[model samples]
Target: MKKLQILAGLYLLCSSSTWAVEPVVSAANIQEIRLSLDSVWVVLGGILVFFMQAGFALIESGSVRSKNTINVLMKNYMDACLGGLVFWLIGFGLMFGVNQTGWIGTSYFAPNEMDGWHWNLLFFQMMFAATATTIASGAMAERIHFVAYIVSAAVVSGLIYPIFGAWAWGSLFDGEGWLKALGFIDFAGSTVVHSIGGWVALAGIIVLGPRLGRFGRNGQVHYLAGHNLPLVALGGFILWLAWFGFNAASTVKAEVSIGRIALNTHLAACASAVVYMVYTLIRGKAILMRGTINASLGGLVAITAGCATMSPLFAVMSGAFAGILVSILPVLMEKLRLDDVVDAVTVHGFCGAWGTLAAGLFFEGRMFNSEIIAVQILGIMAAFIWGFGVAFIVFKVLDKVLGGLRVSKQHEQRGLDYTEHAELSYPEFQHDVTFETDDMTKRH
Candidate 1:
């Protein structure tokens, strides 16, 4: 009886071991299992987000005149392909695979040559590099040369983007970088990536000036309406879908994965679409889907930096407010005589800042041992300064050396397809292609 009791006690102890902090199971096997599962999902997310590039190309092309469709398509394709190469060679090292320095990431080329997590980190960051490059394409659409754009993509992804990303993330220092000390926390990069892209778009627009005949002699704005609404809405939806990857992937840990991240992202996006539609209805642009789409994008951008730190309720509120900003900011930009073809700056830039700041106002918990309000502000300011400064210089240099950023007014009227590509976007409409020396649409 005594021997049997002792044996039973031993069995009980062994069973309870399962609940202990340390596991008797092999750690190596567990690590491999975790890596295999996480990597597949992460890459799949990237693939979905990559599809957004296609959506962007189609929407951008369809919205513009038939003459500019092929031009826009080429830019989008080139940015992703070449942008990948650039990020692979240099940008990844600077953004994530570096030595964790604050000023700039130390590695410039071949960051994944080292063993361990280097390769996965590089792959994830490469996607963001492509995204940043494409943002500029939309802003500079209808005129930027393919050759010039290729160079810009290389420089932006390989150098410009990586440096800023390093600064924004705590990778700037082993302990506390300036922004880290300030308590700035961008969960995913509303300010760091999208806002920076927006700032660059602003600079490009300023340097390139308005599209030819976009404004009248009396300083009146002209209407350069997009050719297709369906395509625009499709692009917006694709972007919304990809956003799940963009925000959720920011957690960067198997342990951190939770329902909170996804719920916050979805709620914010929903609130944004509704709010923008309502705001635009009140503003009298209710008939147009462009406002609704852009507003949703704005909401997504606004929630990016705050998503992980905010509750679902606050995220929805923040997104609704951002939708209003997205709906109205473009009109304001038009009033100031800036011709942003796809509303890239308003959607990415304006909303990025708002989203970053919203975290400060609405953040309810601590996720990374940082203060939400201060960190959010610092991140926004950092993005604005770095993005605006570098973009201004790049635009100025390109404009000066390239002999004006836009084509001659005569070429603008002739259609970029014939002048730049020596081809027509749609051969069926070639016979009716009308060339003019002035704006085709009436002034607004």
Candidate 2:
């Protein structure tokens, strides 16, 4: 009897202790679980976006001349590193800080916020800031001074990109900005990021002028072929993969709707590729690899603003239009005597505007109305004017202060790889390399 009582007492004690220390995980705790999941999803999404920096680097290096490959690679590296650091120090504060009379941000500079969700948001936005500045790299490639490029990258990430971002998405989580108050809807920054990058690229190119051999006498346009098509295609695929995170992660929550966002993004890209390829075939022309890649990217840009707002079918429609837009805009720019080295203006700028407008046309739960369309147009035009105008001033000022943005004739002929970095991308093939300078007889 004594042994039985002792054993029963010990069992009861242990059972009571277990019940007291551990709560049951059930439906009652779902809210907390959901919050944790949301944070995890957001962080993962941010990580995926960071991988796009590699994609940009590959695309840019492959698209330029072989002799300038190293220069392009270095510029891209600086864009992510310097841009991310500057964004963390000042850009994040200006973008997501407390509003100052609905104009700009005033707080969060050098942030020490420890909230997991807030940090996740910061990471995601930092990637976006880096991307915006990097877009200018391809446009100004081959001839720009490294120091000047760094300065321009800093300016865009620290001030121009963030301030505009504040006006549109500063209140993304639960705040309000002037544009948001005006009912502007940019689901994932088509107008805010890509269009801004595009406009800025245009400004820099205009200031820098055409590459030496790009235009011939009598207004003839010469085509400068990219060094590596395989790398370009590979880069495109990587960007396409990254975009799933870009569009889906914008939800900022782990929910079923994320599936829809990702699906829409995929559909849009596919439709765009098909349309571009068909358009080329119908015109009795061989489908160009670079054009198809750019068209796919244009489709991705177009769907970014409306991915969450439109049906999958509408996504297809939007992407088809973007494919057509990217195709024609390049020709239009060339006709104006503007040489955009990689067609960033058309793929990002023109398509970005169209994507924003397409959202107004197809958004669910919002009645098709002139007011919404007008607001969308207003935002697009605002981005174009501000992005282009400010970038122009910045470049022109840098040109004067830095003793001109383009390199000398001698350096240009020798290639930026040798002139700017004093390194060759392919040193083993030195004999095959061509130098256009009169000093060719001189020893290296």
- lDDT by candidate, in order shown: 0.76, 0.86
User: Roughly what TM-score does model 1 have, to 2 decimal places?
Assistant: 0.87
- The segments of candidate 1 whose C-alpha lies over 4 angstroms from its true place after superposition are 1-25, 97-101, 170-178, 254-258, 366-372, 432-444
- Candidate 2: regions farther than 4 A off: 1-23, 26-29, 172-175, 431-444
Please provide, for model 1 over 1-444, each residue's C-alpha lDDT reduced to its tens digit, 9 standing for 90 to 100: 999999999888878957567656698988888987677666766776677787778668767877777778888888888889878877766665445435655643665345555455566677777887788788878776667667777888887788777676635214333565456767787887789888888888888888876889788998788777787888888888888888887665544654688788888888988987776678776446777777778888889988887888899998998888877788799889999998989988888899888877876754334456656766777788888888888777877888766777766776676666666677577545745323333211
Estimate candidate 1's alpha-carbon lDDT, on a 0 to 1 scale.
0.76
TM-scores for all predictions: 0.87, 0.91
Worst 10 residues of 2 by lDDT: 434-443
Error of 1 at 47 (Å): 1.7
Candidate 2 global TM-score: 0.91
lDDT of 2 by residue, 84-167 (tens): 999999999888888745667888888886576789899989988988888888877887888899999999999889988988
lDDT of 2 at 288: 91
